[model samples]
Target: MNFSIARRRMVERQVQGQGVKDPRVIEAMLQIPRHLFVEEAFQSQAYGDFSLPIGDRQTISQPSTVGVMTEALLLQGGERVLEIGTGSGYQAAILSRIAGKVYTLERIALLARRARRVIDSLGCVNVNIRVTDGTQGWDEEAPFDAIIVTAGAPSVPDQYRDQLAIGGRLVIPVGNRGDQVLMRITKVAEGQFTEERLIDCRFVPLIGRHGWQEGES
Candidate 1:
């Protein structure tokens, strides 16, 4: 498969056509070899603008969603970012290209280890992946410039809001199973958050402290 051509079409059609206008986001999407992030069996499907299962019942997000969410972050170079799900490390890779440092957390230990290898193979030194309950956020590294959650949560956890530095932006999918809304929460001031719904999406439930429990699926 001609991955370059497929990625261009994905950006021109699935992403830009859907209102993802951030030039930096588009450039990162076009430059990253998404095929390298998924398993060999699914490499051909990498740029198809659809999610591909990675393992442990998780998946790499669709290309358009990744573009939209990254654009929503309003990332400027040199900002600190926290990613809630590191499935495949694809999204984190994209962010690494735009942000100075990316601290990503994955709930599944196996996924974290595999993604770490994949990320390292790509030489994405700006990204750091850890296995932990993301619902708690990375408190030790709190006050991040931006926080992005790749999974769906029943509601925005208070810890995520607390971790956001004033003026920080958080992009997350929130709601119940089978139905969810992508939301951008902006921290305007201390203890004050402004929420805006961006789009409807379906994602694996965010699991861990303050998140959905196992068997809730």
Candidate 2:
């Protein structure tokens, strides 16, 4: 019943306990009420160590996953970020606390609308949610300081790498539709990047050009 306390416990246990060392990531997990992002029926499980459905077959990534991905970005402060899957907009809400701005894209309009309402209600005005094919990467808003893809893709999308600013970090899951390896790619120079595998993960298929087609999933 006490959501605030539950949230802190989540950060201390599911997040920080998982070895996510970034203070900003931990603080964001502490500040945001995860319960608000899920449907009313599932609100009680918001702070649990698992993902919850947010409709449209999408999920709010588990707390530890969110922490790991966010920490991988290494956000110090005031950097522009692009989130490839808005889902419940919970990740965007978390990023809004540490990033200068968050541009999130969701392929499903209904999900986008729902995420927008929740994000707006939280007064996370720095998060911009748009309904679009995320695999394309927001070219008009190119050169993001950090890029995070919440879904699993068959391979790393070229558009994402092309749009990243030099020295920027991109955290994404790359593999089959049912399984993936979380990867961190840092753009060191034009057409040059270093990759690190963080963890094995499973996420919804990233459906779009340069990702998995609808039929493939």
Strongest candidate by TM-score: 2
Q: What's the CA RMSD of model 2 in angstroms?
A: 0.8
lDDT score for residue 206 of model 2: 95
Supply the TM-score for candidate 1: 0.97
Residue range 1-217, candidate 2, lDDT tens digits: 8999999899998898999988888888898899999999998899999998888788999999999999999999999999999999899999999999999999999999998998899899999888989999999998999999999999998999999999999999999988999999999999999999999999999999889988785
Residue pairs clashing in model 2 are none
* TM-score for each of the candidates: 0.97, 0.98
Q: What is the number of backbone collisions in each predicted candidate, taken in the order shown?
A: 0, 0
Among these predictions, the greatest lDDT belongs to 2
Residue-by-residue lDDT tens digits, candidate 1, 130-150: 788888999998889999999
Model 2 vs. true fold: TM: 0.98
